[model samples]
Target: MSHTFRRRFAALVLALSLLTLPARALTAQEAGQLLQDYYIDDVSQEVLAQPTIDAMLSALGDHYTTYFTADEYAAFLASMEDVQLTGIGVKMQASENGPVVVEVLAGSPALEAGLQAGDLITAVDGVSTAGLEMGAVSALIQGQEGTQVTITYLRDGVSAACTLTRSSILVAATSAQLLEDHVGLLTCTTFGHDTYAHFTEALDQFPQADRWIVDLRDNGGGLTQAALDTLSVFTGGGIKCYFMDGSAQLSALEAKREQISSAPLIVLTDGGTASASEIFSAGIRDLKAGLVIGGRTYGKGVAQSVLDQYTNPELFDGDAMKITTVRFYTASGSTTDTVGVIPHLLVSPDLAQEVALLLSAAPPSGGTAGYYRLDLNGSWYISQKAALAQPEVFAQLLAAIPPTAALWQGSGDGWNSVQPQQAAADHSIPFQSRLFSDVEGSPYAQSIQRLAVYGVVLGNGQGSYFPKSSLTRAQLAALLAQALNCTVPTGESLFSDVSMDDSYGLAINAIAKMGLVEGVGNGLFRPDDTVTHEQFFTIMGRLAQRVSLTFQISRQGATQEDLDSDRLSRFAPWSRLSVWLLSSSQLDELDQPVSLLWDDVTRIDPTAPISREEAADLLCAVLERTGILPA
Candidate 1:
């Protein structure tokens, strides 16, 4: 028989072999029906020509969504629930010699059989495993409960054998601790079968904490229901999560808020955090139950589901596939796919110190109702204070902030961020006396004029307005505060570089209170430091999100034209800023980052320190795109 035919025949036979009573024999018709009815997207018609339907599923471009053979499918289902594992309870990796045991779980058959870390499995059932893949080795080791499998291995250069009878093992999924100051720290590694149960138990263990720090730092998410159950521990059962094809709701999962902890919540995340982790972090922010810290989260918003094995035994037996059935969203309807939850404040992952510092930094106070605060490290500050529910004195105090300074919002709970519809006037009154001689009649004049009108200019009070001067971090803070309308807070600055009495202190405090920006490095905002194109665009991207003008680029769209730099689509866990910039632009030219004026712009050096005119022009363009100003 031909190779393709042999593969197909084996697949069909395997499918038929796995079926019980009332199950029909496998055929081409069965494969077609399964793919058509359950796949998240259309299956290739070329599936019939391939060796097996598994090949078609593999072409779907998602490695996590694929066909699992009978053995693998059984293991997968067992892991999803509290189903038993019929193995030695040791995790391992394939090596040149054999499989190296990483860890032998305590009380597992492996541990009972005296398996130790660094032990190498040389063979299974007397078959040499030198070149066998780890999965194949695993399959050989696992069997029906009470069955005996002879495991041959090498320990300390010694060869030995152990006949282990497999039994079902329950894998626990979460860990917790009562941190200093009665703060609870709970970390969920995966949203697996036992995660929700373990999480509930962890909460019960640390019931005395005044605040809870949920750590999803390196979690490579699992079950959506697991994410929901965990989040409900904080949100006091409402809508844990839901899916909408478009405007129509497909499913709305409700959970009663268990009121696990009434204290303010904190979540820690990093690049490795994804899927279910992303769901929990986003839901926390959307539901206004907590704040997030650390770097941007991994933006994976798709949901998947495996076909019911019991209901479709003929098709599901010895075969399985996870379909990307729906896109997940936050409770506020925010989609966190390519654009993740940008933490209200970005902090280093050194949890001990960061948690202490965050707790020490008191939130905004003395603000009247209805005003916006400088939030999220100043990456997003309220731009329109008058729109808040506070009194005029509060708005007047915050609105009077120097262009290079910011203040906490004088009103309302400091949760949601606000983007001002109108930029404040006389913001740069500190530099009101300057008259720039370099910017007359230039194409950038119109934008520069409006920027100065709003007091975002970085000019000294002297006769010269040095438009060519490199923009400073302090200047950017003040400008953002003025444009965004962040009100006054007299609290100490979060960064070591600025102080409450310093010239830029209010602005620094203003933005930090709002979680709009963070230190340039090492917890220092570096108020005197110059801004670069990369940093500039990163800031602009956050601003774009605040006004709800952020773009969502499809990965499988019409291929974009090759750009100046080859850095467009290659970004991921490492270079999130690039990804955010490219994905949030409606036009391809934004990636090149050339000036809006097609001409007069030379190389767009992302690392180069930007000039005042350049800053004004770019900010103008962003405002126009966000509809705060005319395009």
Candidate 2:
């Protein structure tokens, strides 16, 4: 047969084959089945029952898994390849006159048009380039490939003009240069198709450097295989990472390559570093191959598999599914999913490289820094400097510790763990316990006494604690203000019903300003209004958000679905998620016997008024759970 005729005949046969594909491969149903089979978490029956693919994916609650249209899939594929830019390629910088060409790329339209370095472009088309920023000039210069652009330039104070067609140019995925003290700074923008080769080439360009810093700041991820291959350059041939599938089965990804360099390594990351970038960082850290110095990375430990018509002709027509198949972990088996890879020395993103360079040269000296080593879920050595520098981070680490757990202190490798009470006793610290006579035999006695000691709850002047009385809105505000360290308002109250002379006025205004509460419509503070159980939980949830307090939801605790379908639904729409969060959190147990419905994670009377005793217990439980009040 003739070649053209054969090609047409082959296309016809393929079209016919697609028309006769099996019925089992139809759209939503088959895609749902595939999702259930491949998803990294258990797919609920409710999710699969959705009639359309979009609804199904949304119900699955896995944000990474997505459906992409044909055009979107094409763009995604292009992004995974080498970075491409379309322009009459010439690198330029801003100058007093106009953009001054620094270099003309070989094989580019600019070079072909005879544009040279030191030539300043005075205008584009007929528009003046004066006072336009470099970015503005670049936007004007870059356009659709094959489009024509005219530039007016001054060569040694003489005017000239050139018309050029824009074309696609491939930019290097990685670049490297040597810094002072034999330090190499290698920057990688993407884990694209050519990342491994480009990374190696960059490394090879600076082989004389003894220390290296791989900057992965603002790098979102690309191809997984490319990241693994690039990481192998440092770790050599071995198991680089582990992945856990839906069935909890673990698999290791190994690379069979020899180590490229044995020099000390440092990784720089920021909040934008995700997925493949995180994989590279985790591998280096887990292998003890490098020290990461930057803000916490964007936690994206899941891996996705793209399914398109090319991969499965029978299942897909033009649309595709980017399904999350597994959760990847470091070689040490820890995943950077929600909690990102913590840097060895955390610093601001701009300062991270500077700090890394300093540490690369020599260890930090000349500080009365003490280290607090704690073994919560993992081993961590927190320095006094780190704690003071990032107090919120230090508080979070401390919160991870069980309240009664001992903390260790010492310098370098020598350490001694000291219990809270023991350390206090050894230092002869004066510890006082407050007693309330009225609550001496009550179930909430201990909680009331504890809150009294923390100054969160008070008695009726004569030492008579009214534990069973209903908690008032004003009372609750004062209690929260004290616990949260909210400053007492100095100005006039915002509510018409409240006055500066009122006892709870300052606390009410302070919390209101902080958005913890709202006036009972029409400027009424309603200080005497009863605080309900649901309202209290909602406030606790809001408090958690205000402080950025993240909780580890207990698997055994109630889920949001359960709360929505149960009596808890009586809560306001804005309060449900918060109430669920508080109910599901693994909070410290209360000393007293008063049964708060939230403690059971079920059977809460949402509209019932909360009592003083229950309010105190709940508040104290939150404080202890967040490490605000020691056990």
Candidate 3:
């Protein structure tokens, strides 16, 4: 008989033998025989696939363990290497007290679900975790995508139940915001694939900001390539990082010449920062691109390469191996392995004092009515203020608006002229008039008018401005760039597939220039894709950095009280952005709550193209309220 036939016969006999054995009497060998009988065949490929099987067997502990063919192995590797993973975005610390949320990535599932740092894990999935090890708690929380897990936690002596859905949580290594006084703040959570893109987007969103704060506190680490990419944003060119495998030194990663922003930068870090985070922080610090703040970082400088076991399941069982093969060194040739990168300034955590500090500085003791402070230069506020300040400026701003709109209208024609207003006997203006009219008397009217006048929304060349078109990713970027008066250099498109004629081309280019968006595999910017609420919040946070930067600049020469009151609180994400932008913002001070107009909220058809009008109105409203635009 042929070898294949013999192997098949052996597998069949083994299966028959297992069927005859009593289930209760089965030994480990018997169970192995049963699995082998039903699952394996002795092909050459299968022989080579044994190591993977061994790894999987070793890794399994009562959970599901299945063998993967070569093709299956490749697919599994892809999923593991994916920048996003299914889990809540949080890092746990095993302390004498309990499992505490040490860090929470911005705009993550955990952050959205209202989880916070200092929150103690009391129970997970209904099991009491009173004395559970941090590793156990982490294992309980991590699971397959789409799975739901319940977590019970204590915050300030109050217990709360949070149900979170597991989705691919992309660890945002970098986030940028334009503060109130044109100061930019970029927060690096940990280095990851999307770090550079997101960082650049933040910078592009507020290119003109005078100063910046790059927050790297508690950023553990990931992907060396991502760390280098982030450093490239600040450095001019060449050798961001190098790898050392023992005494063997490899070529260094060189920075590309694409400079995003050169604003004076301040980086925040703590003892929890490690590995790639150290690489980025140290690089920028060494280059004098930014000043480090907070405490020292967690020193982890080893480079690990993942070896997936899919084809040869028997050799590795079924689990993958991540072997540390290299050690990373800074540009200054310092090893950040055990000796962490220390910050330039040391700001310890003071929850009560910080809250009091922010509250006391709260904008001029305004009325309790929800009021948004405007920063005059931000895209949203700039458009709104310019329309309110000079109606003619609105006309000028409208004139420069790009022709990327899906629908267009002839120049010099007002929207009202094209779409006749239905006579409204009630005090409420007709929807069409409300959308297109540039009359600036009422604040509400001014808010509505500024959005229209900014060319964020145009009348269907036929005169009807559809204020309710579902916002798409492309449309939002375009509107934001227009409002900010952002300039996109004419260069070869970074995306391999996006054409100049594509509607999203300019917006994609602008976002890429600012560093808010990145192309997916092989340089493809999926421009027309609809953005989710989380994605939108991430972008808004980036824009909000400018407002924070502005506050920092305004208080540059001020006293500690002035700095604490005006500078910190004004741009404080805890005080301003999160609280003002997200509903969850009400839960914590950092939860910058955003209140949207009823119409605006309804118009966010999450799956459709976000009309230019919606983007314009939302950006304008946010900027106006944040005090980034002059009220």
TM-score for each of the candidates: 0.46, 0.49, 0.35
Q: How does model 2 score by TM-score?
A: 0.49
Which portions of model 3 show Cα errors greater than 4 Å? 1-127, 138-190, 202-223, 241-252, 269-275, 294-329, 333-340, 346-631
lDDT of 2 by residue, 53-131 (tens): 8889888867789887655666766665655799997878787777999667658999999999899999998788999
Report the lDDT of model 3 for residue 259. 60
Candidate 2, run of 10 with poorest lDDT? 8-17
- Tens digit of lDDT per residue, candidate 1, span 1-631? 1233222322112112455545333444665565565444556677644555566555554555556666676666555444456887887877778799966765788899999879999998998889898889989988888888898999998999998989887655566666554667676677765777776787677677666778788787877777887788777778866554322324566666475665677788877888888888877876767667665667676666564454454455456555555566666545565446655444445442244223422233564453345432222223343223223322233332222323443346444423221222323211222224567755676576555533445456443456677888888888777555445577556887788788778987886665656786787888888887667666766665543323322222323443223544332222344333433334544464333321222345667797877777777766544333311
List per-prediction Cα lDDT, in the order shown: 0.59, 0.69, 0.51
| Candidate 3 residue-wise lDDT at 348 | 46
Count of clashes, each model: 43, 0, 86
Instruction: Give the clash count for model 2.
Output: 0
Q: Would you list the rank order by lDDT, best first?
A: 2, 1, 3
lDDT of 2: 0.69
Per-residue CA lDDT of candidate 3, range 191-292, in tens?
A: 655677787777667767766666666667766777777787777677876665433434465667566666555566776777778888778766666555
- Residue 15, candidate 3: Cα error in Å is 36
